[model samples]
Target: MCDYTQREYSCGHFRWIASKWCREYTLTHKRCQPNVTHFEYRADEPCGECKPKEYPPWENLIRRNKQATY
Candidate 1:
């Protein structure tokens, strides 16, 4: 069985992060094998993928310039 760690987000979402692999799988695999297991440890924070990304100041300026030209 594959082992995973549980991550809890402030947005009320849970994500499973891979921790260990069994004999049948390696790092290159995209998905866990069947009969996965989770570690008792948990993390509490906002999920990086679910959080909104902020644009840099220069990027905002470029967008405004393009809009003005239209």
Candidate 2:
């Protein structure tokens, strides 16, 4: 079995990173398959997909034409 590192984000999302390769080889190209075992690690920040997006300050500006009277 291969070894991997699992990262847990604050947003409750997780990701796996391969750390070692297994002795088993693929049937097609004969390459080592790293697909088993994992070690857990905690992260203080949220994942990229879960983070809030920031918009430019100019986007919130309101423009008014002097000729237009309400």
Residue runs of model 1 more than 4 Å from their true location after superposition: 27-44, 63-70
Model 2 gets an lDDT of 0.69
Q: Model 2, 1-70: lDDT tens per residue?
A: 5667777888889887777655563334454544647656566788879889987798669675769877
* Steric collisions counted per model: 0, 0
| Per-residue error (Å), model 2, residue 13 | 0.6
**With candidate 1 superimposed using the best TM-score fit, by how many Å does residue 10's alpha carbon deviate from the native?**
0.7
Model 2: residue 3 alpha-carbon error in angstroms:
0.4
Best by TM-score: 1
- What digit string (tens of lDDT, one per residue) describes model 1 on residues 1-70? 6787776677667777777776667745656554536534234556777678887778746534435553
Best by lDDT: 2
Q: What is the lDDT of residue 69 in candidate 1?
A: 54
Q: Give candidate 2's error at residue 25 in angstroms.
A: 4.6
TM-score of each candidate? 0.57, 0.46
